[model samples]
Target chain A: MPGPGEFELIREYFTSRFQTGSRSGTADNGVELGIGDDCALLLPPAGKRLATSVDTLVADVHFPAGGDPYRIASRALRVNLSDLAAMNAEPLWFTLALTLPHSDPAWLEPFARGLAETAHEFGITLVGGDTTKGPLSITIQVTGACARPLRRDGASAGDIIYVSNQLGAAAAALPVVLGEVTVSPRQQQQAETAYYAPEPQFAVARAVEGYASAALDISDGLLADLGHICDASQLGAELNLDQLPVAVLAHSLQADAAVETALTGGDDYQLCFTVPARHRDAVQALQLPITPIGHLSEEPGIRCQWHGKPWQPRGTGYQHF
Target chain B: MPGPGEFELIREYFTSRFQTGSRSGTADNGVELGIGDDCALLLPPAGKRLATSVDTLVADVHFPAGGDPYRIASRALRVNLSDLAAMNAEPLWFTLALTLPHSDPAWLEPFARGLAETAHEFGITLVGGDTTKGPLSITIQVTGACARPLRRDGASAGDIIYVSNQLGAAAAALPVVLGEVTVSPRQQQQAETAYYAPEPQFAVARAVEGYASAALDISDGLLADLGHICDASQLGAELNLDQLPVAVLAHSLQADAAVETALTGGDDYQLCFTVPARHRDAVQALQLPITPIGHLSEEPGIRCQWHGKPWQPRGTGYQHF
Candidate 1:
C-alpha cells in the first residue's frame, strides 16, 4: 500500500470526519478551506456565544506508548468534546496539534478513519491546526457554541446532583496497563474496545442544557470531580454511594473496591451535574439513564453513604502533576 | 534558594502570572475555581463570540536546544496570540500543556515568569492547563473575543497591501543554530530576545480591525503568508521588493542576502494586510510604521519587483513536514 502523505492523510481522515455541511466544517459547495489555510473561518450564528476548551494527550502520561493510534485519536477528541458538553454547548470546530515520531501510512489510515468517524458522530467540524515532528503527543483544542452554558459556580446549595452514563470504564480497562489480569480472546476484544472507544454523552449533555444549574463531564473520578463543584459553589454534598451507576462488571468487585474505583479512577467521560429540586421532574422526563447520586448542601466538602455505612474518601484520582 | 517543587512552582510562576481582574480573563474575581477541578469553568461574555487558536513549540523543531526557557514561554504564547490578533480579537484566556524533561525549579521559575509576564502584557488570564512529565515541549491554546474579526477571505482584487514591523528575525537568528556565526554580547542579546520574545502585534491588529480588507500575522514568512491571502481571496499580488521593509541590521547585509532573508525567514510576528484603494489613505494615516509593500492583482500568484526585473521565488518558508 502507498504511504499516506500529509495531504491524503488529512483528506481521508479529517476532511469529512466532523459534520461537513455546517458553518464550522468545509464549505458545502466543495470549497477546499480548512487546516491548509493560515486560518479557518467559521460563520457562527448570531447572538450565540462560543465556548472553548483545550486538552492534550501525551504518549506515556495520557495514553500508553505504542497503543493503537486509531483509538488514541478517537478518545482524545471525545474527551475534549465532553468538556464542551459539560458547558451545554454544541460542538462546532476543533484544532489539532499532532506530534508524531514518524509518518507511518498504516497508522495514519486507521487513525484518520477513527478521527473522521468520531467527528461525524459529534457534528463538529475541523477548523485549523498545526502538525509537527516530535515525540508522540496529540493536543486538541475544541470550540463549541452555547445557547446557555451551565457553569461551575451556578449550583445553589439546594440543587440536586446527577451523573450521566456509568463511570470507570477506562479505569476498569487499566488492568490492561498493569497486567494484573490477562484477557481472554473475547474479553481482550471487549476490554480493548471499551478502553479505546468510550462514548461521550453528547445527547444527555444537550438534553440537560438549560435545566442544569452546574455541569461538568467526568474525566477525572466522580468524587474528585464533584469536589470542583464544592469549591466553585462553596457548598458541600452528601452522595448516596449506592446510587452511583457503576458498570455491571465493575459491580462484581468487592463493595469497597467498586466504590474506590468509581470514586477515584479517572477517564469516565460521564457528565456530573447539579439541578434544582423543582426541575427534577423535567430532568427525569428526558428519560435518560441518569444517576441521582447526591444533593448540594450549605456544608462544604463531600460526604457519602455506601451500603448504609459512612463513605470515606478512598484514594486520589488521576494526578498529572 | 529553595528548589521549586511542582505545586509551589505552579502556584508561584504559572498561577500568579495571569491577570484575572479583567472580564476577559477567567472571571472578574481573582480566583479560577476550576484549576484543581475536574474541568475549568470559564464565563464567556454574553453576546460576544469566542475566538481560539492552538500552536505547539517543540524542543529541537520549534526552538533550539538549551534555549532560554523564559523566552520559549513568551514566544509560544505570543505565537498563538498572533492568531487571535489576525482575527482582530482580544485575548481572553489560555491553557498550557507543558512537557518537561525533569522537574528543574530553576528552569521552570524563569519559564513560568516569562509566561506570566506575557499573559499579563496581553491582559489574558491563565484559566486552566495540564503539566506532565515528558520531553521538552509546550503547546498553548489561546482563546480570544472578537467583535468584528478580519478574515483572510475578506480581501478583494483591488485591495492595497501593507505589513507591520520587519520580517525574518527568527530566521535570521538561525546562524545561532548552525554555529556559523558566534553571537556577540549585544547581538546575542538582541537575536536571542527576538528569537525568544516575539512581540505579538496586538496594537497593530487592533488598529487594522475594521480597515483591513483581509489580514493575517506574518508567521510563515512574507511570500508564503501572502500566498495564503492570495489563495484564500482567489487573487494574486505584486510586491515591490524595494519597499520591503528590512530592519537596519538586515539591510546591512549584502543586497541579495538581505532580500532572501526578508522573503523566506520565518517567525516574524508582523501583520500583513490589504485595504481597498479608497481606504488606503485612511489606513496610511494611522501612522503605525506600516509599509505599502504590494498591491493585490486579479491574477493568481505572488510576484516581486526588484531592480525593474521580476524576481523569482527565492525560497519556500518553514515546512513542518
Candidate 2:
C-alpha cells in the first residue's frame, strides 16, 4: 500500500540508471531520443534491416509467483533476448512495460539491479518503457538489425537439424521449484540455476548466419518448436532418440523420465535449427557447441527413430491452452 | 479453460489479419515484415527518423475493472497515439502486450474488433505483440516517423502559449462514471464521449511545425503539464484564467466547478504548446482551432491572473500515486 510514486520510481530505478550497451561508446549511436521524451528517436543505420519482437511474462504463469525478484527480472529480459538471438539479429534496444501491484522499494531495488545487469550483459540499451500499477507482469519489445534474419520456413527436406546445449535441465528443476520433489543440494542448485537464468544463445547468430537454413529457440519444447518449423516450411522431421544431447540433470533421472522430459518439457531456451546437408562440413568447422539431433524428411509429420526402430513419443509437447 | 491455445489465439486475433495503413497501396511501405515468425521487421524510409513510445492502461487503475472491453482497448491505443501526435510524428505501427485473467471469448472478440477499427482509423498497422494469461492490462508500443520532432526543451521566453481544444469535459464525466453523481442524458453522453475517446490533435504537428517552439499533449491536466515544460525548458508561464477555453459540458456545471475542472482535471489529450511571437501570425494563419492562453516568462514557475487580478488554482494536476 505504501511505496514510491511512479515518477520517483522511474527516476530511481530506470531513467537515471540506464546504461548504454553500444560498444561504439558514442552518445548518438542510433538513439537520437530516449526515456524522457514523448517518444524515443531511432535510426536503423544504412543498408541493414530491422527486426523487432515482443514477449510477455505473467506472474505464476510464465514464472512462479513470489519467486526471487532478481531471477524473475533476469529471466524476463533474457527470454526476449533469446528471441532476437534466434532471428540472427544483433541486440540494439529494448523497451520494458512493467505492471506492479504496488511500488514496494524492497522488491523494486533488486529487480532494478537485475534488469540493469542483464541489459548490460546482453549489450541492449534500455531506450524507453512504461511502469503502471497493476498485477505483476513484464512485457518487453526488442529491436535489432541483421542482413538476412533466420526464418522458420527456410528449412528444406534432407536438412540436418541441430540443438544448442542440452535439454531437460530446466524441466528437471520445475518439480523441485513447485515443491513436489526433493534432491541433493548440488542437483537443486544446478536445476535452479538453469531454470532461472537460461542463457540466450548470442554467438549462434554469427556462427550460423550464412549456414543454417532455419532456426528458432526452443521455448515450448523441442517437439512443439520443431512442429512450428514443419508447419511453416511444409517439411517433416526424423529425430534420433539416442542422439539427443540430454542435460546432466535429466541423465540422472529414470531413463524413460529423462527421455520424456528431454522430448516434451518446456523452458530450455536453446536454439533448434536446420542446416543443409551440403553445409555440414562448414557448419561443423565453425566449432560451436551444437549437436546434430535430427533430419528433415519429405514425410508430412514428425517421426521418431528410437534404437533404429520407428516409434512415437507419449506426448507431443507442452501446449499453452 | 475452454478456449483457443496460444498459437490459435494469435492466428485468430493477429497474424491472419494484418493490413496496410499506408496510403501508398503497397504492402512493404514501412513494414518489412509483420505478424508472423519470431519478430516483425520494419524500416524507416530514406532521410527520415523513427520515433517510439510505450504506454500501459490497467484495469481499475486507468479504467473500471469490468468496463466495456471495446472502449477500454480503444482508449488504451488512442492515448499512446496522442503521444506521437505531441511529438509531431506520423502514425506508423504498434505492438500490443495484453494480460488477461483467461481467454474469455466474449471479451476478446469485441476487444479485437475495437482494436482493428481504431487502428485503421488512425492509419497504423499491427506489427507484433504478446498475449498472456494474467490480470487485465493493455500495453502498446508505437513507432512513427518525422523529419524533426518537437521537444519540451525548445520553448523560449516571450513565446505565446496555446491549448489545442477546450478542457474539463473528461473531468466532468468522472463523477458519473464513478456513480457519485447523475446528469442529464445528453450531458452524460457528451461527457462520457469525451472521456472515452478524446481525440488526439494530429493536425497540430503540420500546423505548428517550424512555428511552435515547444510542445506536449495534456494527459496530466494543464497546470501540471505546463509545469513539466517549464521544468524542462527552465522557463515560466503566465496563464490568463479568464481566457481559458472551456468545454460545453464543463460550462454547464456550476461556474466554480466548471473552471476548477477545466483548470485541474486530467485526460484532455489536447496539445499544449508555446510559439514565439514572431511566428504567431504564421501559426494562426494555419487556421487551426487553437486558443492563445498565456505567454512564457523568464521566471521559474507558473503565475495566473483572473479578470486582471492575481489568483491561484486549487490543484496542480492528476498524479497516479
Candidate 3:
C-alpha cells in the first residue's frame, strides 16, 4: 500500500513519462485519445501491418530484487524492443503491466526516467498499461510495424548467418549478481551498465530490413537462438566458433569462459540473422560490425567447429522451464 | 524449483492446448506456433487491424492464492477478451504471462483447459506467453481485429446507456473468501463458477456492433466502468435503477444485497454501451436482453436513483493500488 495507487502510479510513472514520436501525428499523439478510455486506439501506417510481441520479467528469475528500478525499467523495455528489432519493425506503442510489492515514489521517479529515456530513444510511446500490487514483475507487450518483416521461416539453406555487436555482456555481468568477482569502480560502471541497460539493435535492424532473410534478436544466447531459426526453417546450421563475435576469454578469467558465456549465457540483445550468400557483400557494405558466425545447411541438425574439432552444445541454453 | 522446468511444463501443458483456427493456410500452425520459439507469430486476416489490451491479476490482490486455476485462466483471459469485445473486434490471438510460486501440473492442467475452452469458444488462438517462477500472478494480453472499432468519444450527450447481463456475480462470490457464508454443493458450484468463469459478451458485441455509439465491457463495477464512458465523452449520466438489467443479482441474492451487488460488484464481463436516443428502438431490437439503466446527460457528473432516492457508491468498488 506504500506505493502509489494503480491509477496514480500509471499516471505518474508511465502516462506522464514520455513523448510520442514524430511519425505519430498530432491527432494520434503520444497520449492516444483512447488511453483512459476502454481500449487504446493505435493507427498504424497506411501500407504497413502491425507486429506485436510480449515478454515478462520476474524478480530473481529475470532480475535481482532490490536492483535499481531505473535499470530494471531500461532492461525490461529494451528486451521487448529487441524483439521488435528482430522482425525489422519500428516500435510504435507499448503496454506495460508493472506489479510491485509496494508503491514507492522515490523508486518510481528514477524508474520512470529510465523508461522515458528508453522510449524516447526508440521513438516509441507508452500508450496504456495496467499496474497492480504484487511481487515485482514487469510484462511489456510492444506493437511495432514492418513493411516486410524478416521472419524465422524466411531463411533458405546456404544462407550466411550474421550477428550484430559482441555477445556475452549480460552473461559476464552475472558475476555482479553472485559476488564472485568484485567489480572495480569503473568495471562496476561498465558491468552494471551492460547488465541493466541492454542496447537494442534497432539501427542495425532497420539497416538490414531489405537485406536479411530470417532475423531475430539474441536474448537466450547465440546457439539457442540459432536453434530457433533451424527449427523454424527446417534446416541445419554449422557455426564457426572461431568466428563468433565474443571478447577474448584470455583477457578475463579462463580461456573457455567466454565460449560458455557466448554459448549459453542469456540477455544479449544483439541481432542474429541469416542472409542469402549472394547478398553477403551488400550486407557487409553497410559498414556495421557484423560477423558471419555460421551458415544454414541443407541437413537438419546444428553442428559447430571449435579448435578444428566438432562441438555440440554441452547444455541446453537458458531454459526457462 | 519443485515445479516443472519452464520448457517441459510449457510443452506438457500449453504446446498442444488449443486448435489453430487459421490452419487452412500454409503457416506452421498450432495455436500460433507457441513455446519453442523466441516470439510467437500470429497472422490475422488481411483486412483487419489488431486491437490489443492487457490486464494483470495478482494473488490476494485480484484472486485468492489457493483459488482454482481453471477459474483464474478463464477470468484472466475473459477480462482481456472483454476489452477486445468493447472495441467491437473479433477475437483473434492472446498471450499469457503466468507467474507462479511453483510449477504444479495439477494447477496448470485445469488452467490450460480453461484457457483452451475460452479460446475455442471465442475463436482466439493462444499465441505466446512467459511462464516464470515467482509469486502468484497472471497477466494476459489479448489481440483482436476490427475494421472500425467503437470509440468512447463517439458517445453523444443524448445517448441512452445500456448494459448486458446483470452485475455482481463476482461480488456475491466474495463470501467464499471471507468464509462468512457456508457454500452448499450447488452454491459452491455456481459461486466458484461465477468467480472464475466469466462469459465474455462476444456474441452480444458482434450483434450490437455499429448499433452502439460507444461500448465497453464491465470488469470494474458498473459505476466505475460507466465513469470511463462519461470521462471520455465529457458528460454525465442519470441512472434509473428501476430499469436496470438487475435480474442476475435479483435472482441470486436478497433485495438490498442484490442492489448493492448490482451497483458495486466487479467482473461482470457484460457490455455497457450507449446508443443515440433516436436509434434506441433499433438497438433494442437486437434483443440481447439489454437494460436501459441510464441516459447520458448534457451535465457532467454521475447520478443514480435507487427506490426514488439518490444513491452513490458506498465504498470503492475494487482498488488494485
| Each model's DockQ score | 0.31, 0.73, 0.48
Residue A252 lDDT, candidate 2, scale 0-100: 74
Task: Give the top-scoring candidate (DockQ).
Answer: 2
Query: What digit string (tens of lDDT, one per residue) describes model 2 on residues B1-321?
Result: 588887888788767666432322236447866776677767667777778899988888887767777878788889999989999988888999888877777888878887888888998888888888888888999988877788787889999999987988888777766566788888777767787888988887767888888899888889988888887789999999899998887878545588778888888898999999998888888888899999999999999998899988889888766
Best-to-worst lDDT order: 2, 3, 1
- lDDT score at residue A142, model 3, on the 0-100 scale: 82
Model 1 chain A poorest 10 in a row by lDDT: A23-32
For every model shown, the clashing-pair count is 1, 0, 4
Steric clash pairs (candidate 2) = none
Interface RMSD of each: 3.6, 1.2, 2.5
lDDT by residue for model 3 (A1-321), tens: 366566677767665665332322344322334345556655556555456778889988898877888888988999998888887778878888888888889888988888888887888877767888888899998877666667787789999999988887778877765466885677667677777878778788788888888888888878788888887789999989888877432125334577868777788888899999999999899998789988999898888899899987686478775
Poorest 10 consecutive residues by lDDT, candidate 1 chain B = B22-31
User: What TM-score against the true chain A does chain A of each candidate get?
Assistant: 0.89, 0.94, 0.92
Q: Clashing pairs in model 3?
A: A3-A103, A321-B5, A321-B6, A321-B7
lDDT of 2 at A47: 76
Our model 1 lands, by Cα RMSD against the true structure, at 4.7
Better of 1 and 2 by lDDT: 2
C-alpha TM-scores of all predictions: 0.82, 0.94, 0.89
Q: Lowest summed lDDT over 10 consecutive residues: which window, candidate 2 chain A?
A: A19-28
Q: Candidate 2: where is the Cα deviation over 4 Å? A: A19-28, A178-182, A253-256, B19-26, B178-182, B253-255
